[model samples]
Target: MKNKLIKMLVGIGLVMGLAACGGGGEDTASGGTDSAHADAEKIYNQKCSSCHGDNLKGGMGPELTAVGANYSQDEIADIIQNGQGAMPAGLISGDDLDKVAEWLATKK
Candidate 1:
């Protein structure tokens, strides 16, 4: 009886451990995409909205509604990092630069 109880507890622990580990992989994969978009939106609201408009409708900066149609991802990223005519350079950097560029590319 003692041996049987010990085996049962070990089995339960193994099953619980496996279940916990299995769920995290899937959640992390999906969560990355969600997190990137959320981060992008946050960054946009904080830095770009002042000039670009809250909805990309054009404020001090021009309307960005169809910016994706006009520029490629690399081009946009470059413009962001290097700055264009009246715009300043490097408003965002690192992973944020990539995320914001990707998110804006979907604006079309």
Candidate 2:
């Protein structure tokens, strides 16, 4: 009975983990993120293009995808707000930042 109970708990845990993955992260295509991203991209071109390149191909600043695959949207937003390594803070704000994060993640 003890062994059976442990297996049952493990099965439950696995199911819960899978369900957690079906998260509610906003989709850029249909949501307000689309327009927001447009706003953010314009901010990028104006404030960041000099260092990161017009398309974020990298110039004075590291490529936007420096570690793209490993980061999440929230993490990117925080980075944008706090600024990283060679980047400065407060260049973008609120909805614009969130949208940029979504666009950057899809780059590669």
lDDT of 2 by residue, 46-98 (tens): 55566677778876566775435867777877887887765666556665666
Question: How much is 27 displaced in model 1, in angstroms?
Answer: 15
lDDT of 1 by residue, 1-108 (tens): 999677556644543343344311111245577777777777777667666788889766679989988988788899988978666676676677788798888778
Which pairs in model 1 have colliding backbones? Answer: none
Name the regions of candidate 2 deviating beyond 4 angstroms.
Answer: 1-36, 65-67
C-alpha TM-score for every candidate: 0.69, 0.59
Return the lDDT, model 2, position 37: 70
User: lDDT score of model 2?
Assistant: 0.62
- The per-residue C-alpha lDDT of model 1 at residue 71 equals 88
Clashes of 2: 0
